[model samples]
Target chain A: MDNQTISPRQFMFLVILFSVGSSILIVPTPLAANAKQDAWISISISVAIGLLLVVLYNHIATLMKGQTFVQATIAVFGNWFGRVLLFFYLSFLYILASLVLRNIGDFMTTQIIPETPLQFTHILFLIVVIWGAYLGLEAIGRSSEMFMPWVVLLVFFFTITLSPQIKMENLQPVLGNGIVPVVDTSTFVIGTPLLEMVTFLMIIPYVKDGKTKKRAWILGTFIGGAILTLITLLCILILGSDLTALNTYPSYKLAQKINIAGFLEGLEIIIAIIWMITIFFKMVVLYYSTTVGIAQFLTMEDHRPLLLPLGMGMVVLSIIAYPDVAYFETFINETWFPFAITHGLIIPLIVWIGLLFKSKKQNKTQQEPS
Target chain B: MWSMISIIVLALGIFLLEFPKLYKKNRKKEAWFFTIFLLSFTIISVLESLEVELPNPLDLIQTFYKMIGF
Candidate 1:
């Protein structure tokens, strides 16, 4: 278990999949609602800011080299305070895993399989996630590597087929409402999938090559952000801002618009497939981190034993996490940004500053020649 | 009632599957931790199956942000 490692390529695939995860389905709607025709602009700006955030995360990873997020916190803050912080961080990861589970379950129930119980969808999904985590990171990495091309092919087909429907006039009077709305909409975009990339810190240490890891991290983010931006642009161009904002799953609807000579129609399932694949890897990564974080927290050797129980907890939490879609919407729009910021930005910044101070103290001690 | 029974049975099945592995290895601490987590979650699952009220965790974040005036 200790010797397990994933290649830089596999790491990149996981990052790409994680970035594109739930955002592919839901991001365009809110962006369109707030920024209108300039929603793509909002995402582009957020992607830029998200790049900087990734740089910050990379720096923290370098500073605490070879330590997982849990270990890094404990290393930086000392035992007691670190454990306290770890408690909050662990809960954050756990809640996030549950939320991601809930996201898919909700999507399945409302969009794809309306008659199925949410619990059934959640259980089936958790079984796969739990099994992936049980197999450990190496298997997860290999599987992601195998599945990467399919995700890319599906996304490419979805985009190319929808190209014919894009209306140039939908993006008329660019930034017409001024940059204010675009910037405002970007706040929501930055919180999700962007700040949420901070979770990748847990897996960064396990990537095999030290030199290429940073490159993989940044490139994966860039590609994922580009894919998301393309999808958002298509939604606005084809569906228009009003209709895009109206639909809960705009991209799913966008896929339904695929009509190649009126023969290749109803490829909406392509969107569903792409979303399910990305979200599965995303949840697996999160679930893996949560389980591994707990095992490390408990000073245990392996994380597999905790998988089933934690998964059961996740199923229950996923159901109760959002009473209905309305509350979930409010939470994502109103509350998620700040909550994500606390864990993603503020905590990492604190740890980075702490590392700097510690290193400076070490320099001072070395100069004293005692 | 059926939901409750199924939940309990599922919990027991999970326990049976996992506990023996820890027991065979003589990992007492690991076993204890596993039992605590499983038991707590099982109780929650049963409560959930019964349609009992369970606090949504995200509400904590929402409340915190509200207090901070976000």
Candidate 2:
């Protein structure tokens, strides 16, 4: 497992890319719908909460220093229960990956390439993801390092180019409706993307230097969350809260609004490119983790064989995942918050407690022998 | 019909490319998993492309949500 180690810097880029993921294009609309003018504040709160989750995930990673999340689960619980839990966790990851695939597929069909069928878009994306995962984490890590700089530059480009449309009055009356909406929005924001850092636990063991592991996790999460917050602020500023909330892809629309003396009139291509790259990274991370985790759980020597079949399953799952965009939105709005909390927060919390007791017992036994 | 044939051809191409290695490695269980998964996906894609109605996975979650009164 340690045969393929990635540098801390690459790890950080992966985290940033993973956190940005599919959430970048779509997250702001929900934030604006929930928090209105206070969307930025909601995102800020999510960042804070996200950092806290990073800490908790780091603690669990530290407790079982060299084990993947699946290994840790099996170590904490006996094999039978652990296998059951691992199965459930892996299932959750696969479902999430499929949904993400569906997201980009939906984005392409509805927003960019309406004439192209959704399955083609999905199959094309999955092909890249399958190949990336086949190359394994090291390649994915290096790819992130190479691409993250451009992603950052593009983000800044959007921020600066769209500056003319930003209205200070749009963000006026902050907390005028009190902090309820802000808090409400924060839960959705944090639960959806921030706490999804739980998935990173599976990759933590591959970091070369244990000392820098926690720092990379925290820094990556914070940087990613900050970018999200900045984008949320930009959405609110440029489009105003009402319009931002109304649009499906607020950031994409915001990109369309970028008119730098008519030179960059149609910048949605740039936004689409950003989304494709980030979602590719995101899906690869999730897909890699899912395939590798399944291989490990099943005691298979190679995860590559699982990729194509599982990738196919994912395409089908993505199709069946939602009947339409409206149902998808309803899932995000209603069920996803609790679902994310249960998997991301509650399960990890239990495992952490179990780890604490297991460590304590080990310490006591070691002391008695001494 | 054309899309369905293309999907089947694609599945067969991928199967031939991938399965030999797994067979040489003596990974029978994995090979079987791959075979079944690929076959099912091909069928689903063909059915979907043909506009045949199929059960959706989303409704399961929706049912769970309803049960929980969410």
Q: Worst lDDT window (10 residues) for model 1 chain A?
A: A157-166
Query: Per-residue lDDT for A1-370 in model 1, tens only?
Result: 3668999999999999998999987799999999999999999999999999988988888887788878878877888888887787788889888998888888898888999999999999999898898888999999998999999999888878878777999998898999999999999888988888878888998988888999899999999999999999999999899999999999988888888887878889888999999999999999998899989888888888899999989999999998889998999999999999988898888888987787788789999996
User: Where is model 1 chain B poorest over a 10-residue stretch in terms of lDDT?
Assistant: B55-64
Task: List runs of model 2 lying over 4 Å from the truth.
Answer: B39-53
Docking model 1 quality class: high
Clashes of each: 0, 0
Q: How close is every model to the real structure, measured as TM-score?
A: 0.98, 0.95
Residues A1-370 of candidate 2 have per-residue lDDT tens digits of 4368888899899899888888897789888887889999988988898898889899999997688888888889978988887776887788889989998998889898899978889989999999999998899999998899999999989888888777999999989789998998888878778877788888989988988878998999999989888888988998899999999998898888888776758987888888889889999999999988988887777788778878777887788777778888888888887777778888888788888999999999999988
Q: What DockQ values do the models have?
A: 0.91, 0.54
Best by TM-score: 1
TM-score of chain B of 2: 0.90
Colliding pairs, model 1: none
Q: iRMS of candidate 1, one decimal?
A: 0.6
